[model samples]
Target: MAYMSGNPSNVSFVGAFLNTLGDRLFSAFNVAVEANGRMARVEALQALSDEQLAAKGLRREDIARHVFSDIFDV
Candidate 1:
């Protein structure tokens, strides 16, 4: 008669699953932070007086567009 031993470790996929989850969570956090920062900039610009805005070469109507100028051409 021969005796057989089963596999010792069973949770083989757990590490990979945790790593992927961590990466996704980190990416989401970064996106939220970036959007928050941009919105803050937009709000700051909106609070400025027309003269103050013109001093910075930005217009009230173009607040969002100006804040995102680096990412957009408008």
Candidate 2:
């Protein structure tokens, strides 16, 4: 009689489960870091006075546009 080897189905299920879990965790982490960085930028800009903003050739009205523009634009 031939002996049965490990179950390939179970192996595939475990691999898929781990891959999905890792993807979710990584996505959550990326979102959190992006939010934190955006908040930091807002805080830094808020801390600047009108004169300081002017010296940098920026205005308060331009803050959002400046922060959210594409990386290639910057």
Candidate 3:
């Protein structure tokens, strides 16, 4: 009997692993961007005065909640 060496199972395993790894990498990338964006929003809001906040319809009390929403709404 001759030896046969091609394995479809190995190909499928490798493809699945690559796909999972790609998804994890993409998720991590998105999380990092979201965190950075939230930080920027917080900074921007903190830089504004109480009068400026009222003018823009954003209360000082809602800064944290609104900044988090602005980043994660995507």
How many residue pairs collide in each prediction? 0, 0, 0
What value does the lDDT take at residue 27 in candidate 2? 100
Per-model TM-score, in order, reads 0.71, 0.68, 0.74
RMSD of 3: 3.7
Report the alpha-carbon TM-score of model 1 versus the true structure: 0.71
lDDT by residue for model 1 (22-68), tens: 99999999989999999999998999999999999888999998778
lDDT of 2 by residue, 7-40 (tens): 9898899999999999999999998998789778
Off by over 4 Å in 3: 1-6, 70-74
Candidate ranking under TM-score, highest first, comes to 3, 1, 2
For candidate 2, give the lDDT of residue 60. Answer: 89
Candidate 3 structure quality by residue, lDDT tens digits, 22-43: 9999999999998898889889
51 Cα displacement, candidate 1 (Å): 1.0
**TM-score, cand. 2 vs. native:** 0.68
Q: Which ten residues in a row have the lowest lDDT in candidate 3?
A: 65-74
Model 1 CA deviation exceeding 4 Å by range: 1-12, 72-74
As a TM-score, model 3 comes out at: 0.74
